[model samples]
Target: MTSLSPTTRTTLGRKRNRAASDRETLYAVLDEALICHLGVVHDGTPLVLPTGYGRDGDTLYLHGSTGAASLRTAAGELDVCVTVTLVDGIVYCRSLNNHSMNYRSAVIFGRARALTGRDEKMHGLRVLTDHLAPGSWEHSRGVNAKEFAAVSVLALDLSEASVKLRAEGPDDEPEDVAADAAWAGVLPIRTVFGEPEPSADLPSTWSVPEHVRTRVSEAAAQ
Candidate 1:
C-alpha cells in the first residue's frame, strides 16, 4: 500500500488514532463520496458551502457558476480547502458522551487553478460529469459555447490531503461498560440508490437507461 506524506496542514493533531496514513484510503473516501464542502476565505470572511466535486487522478474539480462570488474569490491567490465525508453508521453507547459515529472523511488543502483554456475546461467538465453522472457525457449532448461560458471549474492538486476513518463501535468508559448502562451497539447505515423515478413530464412508458441502471448497481455494490 502506498503511504501518504503528511504535511503540516494535512496532519491530524486530534483523534490521532482515527487518522488514515495511506493514499489508497484517501482515494477510496473521495471515490465513494458524492458531495464535498468547499471552504474558502473571501473578503476576509470564511465561507464554507456544499458543492459537487469530481476527481481526476490527483486533481480534484469543484463545480460552481461563473457568477458565484465564492468561486470568483477562490480562483484568486488565496488557498482553498475541500472536505468529503461518508457516514457508515451511528454508534450508540452507554453514555451520552460516548455516543459517536462511524465515518470516512477526507480533507484536501491546496491552491486551486481555474481552468480557462477550451481543451482543459472541456476535460475538466468531462471528468466532473463522468464522476457525478456516470456515462452521461457519452450518452448526452456535449456542452455548447453558451453553456460552457456560464459554468466555472476549479482544479486543486491533491498534493496535500488527509483521510480519516472511524469504523468500529462506540467507546464507553470501563465503569459504564461494566454497569451495562444501556444498549450499546452500532446501527449500520447503508446508502443504496432506490428505483429510478422519472419526472412527471416524462411518459410512464419510458424505461430506465443502461447508464442509470449501471450507476444504481454500482452504488448499491459500494
Candidate 2:
C-alpha cells in the first residue's frame, strides 16, 4: 500500500494514530460515500453545504445550478474544503466519555476550477452521474443542450487531502471496564437500497432493470 506523503496542512495534531496515510484508503472512502460537505468562504464567513459528488482518478467533480452563488464563487478557482464521512457503527462504552462511533472520513483541500466546453462539461456531468447511480447515465435519457447549460460543474484535484478512520470497539477506563454496569457493544449501520418503487405513470410491464436489481442485491449483501 502506497502511503500519502503528509504535508504541513494535512498533518494531524490530535489522535494522530487514527490518521490514514494511504491514497487507496482515501479513494475507497470517497467511492463509498454518497454525499459530501463542501466548505467555502462566502463574504468572509465560512459556509458548508451538503451535495452529491463524483470522483475520477485524482479529480473530484461537483455540479449544481449554474446560477448558484456558491458555485459561481467556487468556479473562480477559489480555495475550498470538501469532506465525506461514512458511519459504520455506533460504539457503546460503560462510560459516556468513552463512547464513540466507528467511521471513515476524508477531507480534501484544493482550489476548484470551473469546467467549460460542451465535451468537457458533458464528461464531467457523466462522471458525476455514474458515480452516484453506477449505470444510470447509460440507462437514463441524455441531457439536452438547454439542460446542460442550466448547470455548472467544478473540478478539484485530490492531491492535498487526508483520510482518517476509526473502526474498533469501545475503549473504557479500567474501573469502568471492571464495573460492567452498562451494556457495551457495537451496532452496525449501513446503507440499504430497498426494493425499487417504479414511477406511478410507468407501465406495469417495465420491471426493474438487471443492473438496478443487481445493485440492490449488492447493497443488501454488504
Candidate 3:
C-alpha cells in the first residue's frame, strides 16, 4: 500500500492539537467505519447526505441510483467533502462545559467523477459489497449488466484528507475536580452483533455461513 504523506491541507486541525498525523491511524479509522457523510453543494446550497462507501487504495467509491439527484449533481463536480466519524466513548465531567465525547473522524476533499465502463463498474460494485460483508462477494450472485447500468458510481481521489481524534477523558478545572459532586470518568462505547436471524423462506437445514459466524465471533472477541 502506498503511504499518504501528511500535507498542510491534510493536517488534522488548525492548532494541530487533536490532529492524528499518522497515515496508518487515519487509514485504520476509515477502514473500520461502515458509513460516511457526503457533503455537496447544489445550486449554491449546502447539502450533507449519509451513505455507504468503499476504499480502494487512494480512492473511495460511492454507489447510488443514477436517477438520484444528489449523486447526479456530484458527478463531475470539483467540490465535495466526505466525512466519517466513530464515537468511542462518553466522558463525564464535573462541569457541563468540560464534558466531551471521544471520537475519531476523517474529512476528505476532492473532485468526484462518475465511473464509466463495465469492468470498472463491476469492480466498484464488488468493493462496495465486500466492504459491508466480508467474504459475501463469492457467496452471492454477481451483479449483472442490467443491474450495473441502473446504479451510478462516483470515485473520489484521496489527495486531500485529514483525520481528527479525541480519546482522552473529561478535562475539568482544579476547582471542579476538588468539588467532586459529579462523577468524572469515561463510559466506553462499542458496536456489537446480535443473534443472526434466518430468512423465513430458507430451508430448515440451511445453516449460517462461515463469513457471518466469523464476523460475530470477531466482534465478540473485540
Candidate 4:
C-alpha cells in the first residue's frame, strides 16, 4: 500500500479528511469513471474538454483526431490536468448549508507525450478499447493504416495525482437533528445500461453479444 506523495499542486488546503492517501484509491476512481475532463492551455487561453480515456498501470491514455488543435497542444510537452469523478448519491441535509453529495474523484497533473511508434500506438489503442468497450477489440476489426493516421494519442503519467472521496450519508447539524427540523437522507444515484438497440441494417436473427449482456446484468445486480 504505497502512499501517494502529495505534490504542491495536489495538497488539499481544506477538507483534508476527504483526501485519499493511497495510489490504489486513485486507480480505483479512474477505473470506475468512464469520462474525464482534460485541461490544458493553448495560445495563452485555457481549454478544458470532456473526453474518454484508458488506463494502463501508472499511465493514462487519451485520443482524438489528429487535426484537433487541443490535442496537439496537450502533446507538446506542456502541463495538463485530467480529472475523473463518480457520483454515488445526493445528500439531502436538514439545512441548506449542510447539503452535499457522495462522490469519488481524482485529479492528475503532468505533461503528456505523443505516441508515435507503431507498437506503442497500437498498445495504447488496445488499452483504450478495452477500457471503453470491454470486449470490442477482440470482436471488431483493428485500425488500418489510413484509420491509424487520422487519430492522435497522448500518454500521461500518474506520478502527480490526488484523490478525494465522500461516501457517508448526510451530516446534518446537531441542532437540526435534535429539533427534527427537516427530512434528511440520501438519494442514491446510479448508471444502468438499458436495452440494446440493434442496428437497422443488421440481420434480424442477430442477437445481442454476450459481453453486452454481461454489462447490463452487472448493472442490474448493482
Candidate 5:
C-alpha cells in the first residue's frame, strides 16, 4: 500500500488544474467510474486499452480472459497506469480553443500481479461484480471453481496515483470575452439510469431487488 505522491506540474488545462491530491477524492472517482483505460508498455511500445475494473481498499482489480495477450504481459512484473474519467459537462466558451470539458479523472500507476488464490479470486470477482451493479453480487449466482480458473485477475496498488478534475464554465480571457459574443457557459451532463425493465426471461415471481430499486430512486432524485 503506497501513498499517493504530490503532482508537481500545474497548468490551466483541465487535465492539470482540476487535479485532486487527496486520496479520498481519487478513490471515489475511481469507484464511480465503470471503465478504466489501462496504459502499459508492451515490447517497448505504449498501449492504452479501456477495460472494466474494481477497487478494494487501495488496490484496483482488473480481469480478463486467461489467454488475453495484454493480461499475460501485464500479469508479469511490469508497471502499469490505469486511468478513469467521468465527464460532468461541456464547457462552451467565446473562443474555440478555450472551450473544454468539465470532468473528474483518476490516474493510477503501479506494478500489477496476477491473483491466483481461490479466496482472493472470489473476493476479487465479488468486488468487480458489486462495483458494476452494487447489490448484484449476493443476488446473482456465484462463480464456480472452473469459471474462476478460466478468468484472470490482476491487482494494482492505488499508491502512486493522481486525481484531476475540472468543473465550471470555460476560462476565457477578458479580451476574448469582449471580442466574442458566443454563449459561454457549462452544459451539465450526467449518467442517468432509465426505468428498470425486467429481464425478458425473468421469472414472474421475481421482484426488483432493493439494490436495483434504490439505485433507480437515487438516479431519479439526481
Candidate 6:
C-alpha cells in the first residue's frame, strides 16, 4: 500500500472521500486502460485528445504522427495532463442526485521530453506497441526506417500523479432508506475482447495466431 505524495495541483478539490493515495492503485488503473486523454495548452488555448499510451516503470510514453501539431508542441518542454479512467459499475440510488458511478481513475501532470535518438525512439515504440498488442511486436514485421521516421514519441515521468476510486454501493438518504421503495444497486460493467477477424485480403486458410487467441480468451475471462 505504498502511497504517492500529492502536490498542490494533484490534490482533489471536491469529493475528497473518493481519493485514493496508493501508488499501486495508480499503476493498476493505468495498466488496465487502453486509451488516455492528453491535455495540453497550445498557444494559450487548451486542447485535449484521446491517444494510446504505454507505461514503463515511472515513465509514460505517447506516440503520434510527426506532423501532428498538438503533440509536436507538447514535446517542447511543455506541461501536459494525462488521465485514464475505468468504470467498474453504475450505481443507482433512491434519489437521482445521489446516483453515481463506481470507477478507478488516474491523473498525471508532467513536462514531456521528445525522444530523438534512434535507440531511444525504438525502445519507446517497442513499449507502446507491446502495451497495445502484447506479443505482436515480436511476431509482426519490424519498423522500417521510413515508417519510424514519420512517428514521434514523447516520454513523461510519473512524479506528480494521483488516483481516485469509488467502489461503494449507492448511498441513499436516511428517509429514503426507511421508505425502502426505490430500487438501488450496482450494475457491473466490463470490456471483453471479441474473436479476432482476419483481414479480407489474407488467405482464407490462414488461422489465428496463439498470442491473439490467448488474449481474447484472457480478456473474456477477466
Best by lDDT: 6
lDDT per residue (tens digit) for residues 1-222 in model 1: 777766777765748788888888998899888889888886788888887888888898878653233546533533788899999999999999989999999999988777788898888999889888887998888899999997778888888888888999889999999998599999999878888888899988889889998778876887
Worst 10 residues of 3 by lDDT: 66-75
Model 6 per-residue lDDT tens digits across residues 73-178: 5336557888899999999999888999999989899887778889988999999998899898989999999999978788889889898889999999999989
TM-score of each: 0.90, 0.92, 0.89, 0.94, 0.86, 0.94
- lDDT string for model 5 (1-222, tens) is 333674442223445456677788888898888888887786788888877789999888886542223545533645677889999999999888988889888877777777878888788888888888898887878777688777877788876788788877789989988887788999999897887899999998988889998988888888
Which lDDT tens digits does candidate 4 get at residues 119-207?
A: 98889999888888899998888889999877777888998999888999889879999989699999999988888889899999988
| Cα RMSD to the true fold for all candidates | 2.2, 2.0, 2.6, 1.8, 3.2, 1.8
Query: Candidate 6: lDDT of 2?
Result: 73
Clashing pairs in model 4?
none
Clashing pairs in 5: 18-165, 19-164
Tens-digit lDDT track of model 3 for 1-222: 344555666673454787776667767887899988888776788878887788887788876542223545533544678889999999999999988889998888887777787788778877788788888898988777687777877778877787788899889999999988889999999988877899999999989999888888888888
- Show where candidate 1 strays beyond 4 Å: 66-78, 219-222
Tell me the lDDT of model 3 at 59.
81
Give the TM-score (vs. native) of candidate 4: 0.94
Candidate 3 colliding pairs: none
lDDT of every predicted structure (CA atoms): 0.83, 0.84, 0.78, 0.84, 0.78, 0.85
Clashing pairs in 1: none
Cα shift from native, residue 172, model 2 (Å): 1.3
